[model samples]
Target: MPRSQPAIPICPPFPISGILRAARRRSDLSQRELARAAKVSAATVGRSESGTILPSINTFATLLAAAGFFLAVVDPDGNVLQPMKTRDDLRDGAERLYPAHLDVIPDPEPGEWWADIYGLARPPETFYRDRRRRDYQRRLSQWQVRVSKHRHLPEPRLHHYRDAP
Candidate 1:
């Protein structure tokens, strides 16, 4: 028998279609114009406005940003979770609230670039030298361990000594 699964609580549906249409009209952009501005397909925008499908989060944000607006999270009681009036305000809020953490970057590509810079890629010479040093040190430690383990035993007579009369 199949195992019983826990019920997933249903989230209240957001009126994404209506919002998309209203925002686009307020921005004075046709569906095609908004699509072009947001770098998404025109058909996708049309479909989203028609409620046939919801656009991806990225698409939604792109479209809204094109209209000088953005999305914000709110608590279950409808209180804004991270309220801010502008991009700079958001930056200030994060800096004040989470000082030790990194600054929030709006662009996605730079985050990936930072990941590469962090550890995945390195300067060629430095990486090669560090890798070689680590390998040599590891091998030296292993050899020392092997030698210590057998240090108490007498050396076996060399089988290659043919003239040992």
Candidate 2:
């Protein structure tokens, strides 16, 4: 059975999606426009901002890239606390070159832990690095693909939703 996200915390207030919404507004892009740029559906953005959605890692990454932001939990002075990447970005990259294995399979024995050939310890960073690498490769490939296909892709303004169709 799949587990669900814990209830929203009341104190420090996890409002990353709010940041996305604000960024989208700053970009002057509608939900549909942001969705298209992010390669996700507009409803996804709607749900996320409304707090009805718990975005996958990859989805969040796409949103960040689309909204022109990077993922980093930082202190008031801008010291990075947690570096994060979206799962969708990694999965998409993985899908392009190799089969994506972005998920962590839980140990059935509950106490068991296994290290893979990559020498990743019991708790591995493979999942994070895999997504980050994939995100970079996918963006690079998309740029190449577009340049080869279209002679030019404008100075990267917000993509038209109709263009996606």
The superposed Cα distance between candidate 1 and the true structure at residue 66, in angstroms, equals 1.3
lDDT of 2 at 67: 82
Kindly give the number of clashing pairs for every candidate: 0, 5
73: Cα error in model 2, Å: 3.0
Scanning candidate 1 in windows of ten residues, the lowest lDDT window is 122-131
lDDT of 1 at 40: 87
Off by over 4 Å in 2: 1-11, 75-77, 81-165
Task: Encode model 2's per-residue lDDT on 1-165: one tens digit a residue.
Answer: 243566853558667678788888888899999999999989999999788988987788789789897677666677988644444433322354223444333332323333354554444222323444444455565776788764575433332334422
Q: 1-165, model 1: which lDDT tens digit per residue? A: 343567875787899999998999888999999988888889999999999987889889898997777998866678987643344334332344323223343333432333455655421111112333344455555555777875665543322224332
RMSD of each: 21.5, 20.2
Q: Against the true structure, whose lDDT is highest?
A: 1
Worst 10 residues of 2 by lDDT: 104-113
| Cα lDDT computed for each candidate against the true fold | 0.64, 0.63
